[model samples]
Target: MDFRGQISAEFLLIVSFIVVIVLVFSSIAGPQSQENSIATAAREGATGAISEMSYTNVSMKPMRVTGIKITGGSNRVISISFERPVPPEYRALVINRTVESLLTVSGVKPVNSTTVRLGDRTYTVQI
Candidate 1:
């Protein structure tokens, strides 16, 4: 019985197994990382928007950002909503200048309309 060919075959089998394991783990981790990144972008964008608004008017109550939704493919649509109603005119200005400026990542685009309600405002940002 010749042992040389057996050793080479066993080595190849082990290498293939390791490659498969790596691929499996990477596939599992990929979506999770993308989700985390999206969440981070939302939080950062909200924070910057709030800060910008606050800086302009010391008397104005701090605004609460309620949610952020990411849609579309390479040219992404980022929808950010605030709990408090922003004036119709200010909505476009704030999102375009303040919010969009902060979320300057290549493909992300923030929608100009803000969803609002007259109730207790929640600052919680959801991705």
Candidate 2:
């Protein structure tokens, strides 16, 4: 038996094992990272929409300041909640049109609903 050949084989095996471990770790982290990215995008879009939107105040003047919370989970489910001070009229419009436009999935559109639960380990994009 050539001891030199055995040593080379052992070193190669160790290196291959390390590479496999790294690959496994990365694969595990990939989906979570992707979810984070999605969250970031959602936040930015929602912020833009809210900033550009205005609701008429009691004085009948367009008011641009309001709280909008948009939460999107997996399976293309979105839940939009407005602050207590937001006007109901604008809330409906935002949920129906603006949010749907913002989160345009391939074959699905957002429907007005109150349910937010999707599944376990959901990635919630809140803004």
Q: Write the per-residue lDDT of candidate 1 for residues 8-74, one digit (tens) a residue.
A: 9999999999999999999999755654565555656665766677788787677777776765543
Per-residue lDDT tens digits of candidate 2, residues 1-127? 6587888899999999999999999988976565454444444444445555643234433334233343344544434343434455555544434344434422223333312222233322222
Q: By lDDT, who's the top model here?
A: 1
lDDT of 1: 0.56
Model 1: residues with Cα > 4 Å off, grouped in runs? 24-35, 72-75, 97-127
How far in Å is the alpha carbon of 60 misplaced in model 1? 2.2
All predictions: root-mean-square deviation over Cα?
8.7, 5.9
Q: Which stretches of candidate 2 lie over 4 Å from their true place?
A: 54-76, 80-86, 92-127
Q: What TM value does model 1 have?
A: 0.58
lDDT of each: 0.56, 0.46
Candidate 1, residue 120: CA error in Å?
39
The estimated TM-scores of all candidates read 0.58, 0.52
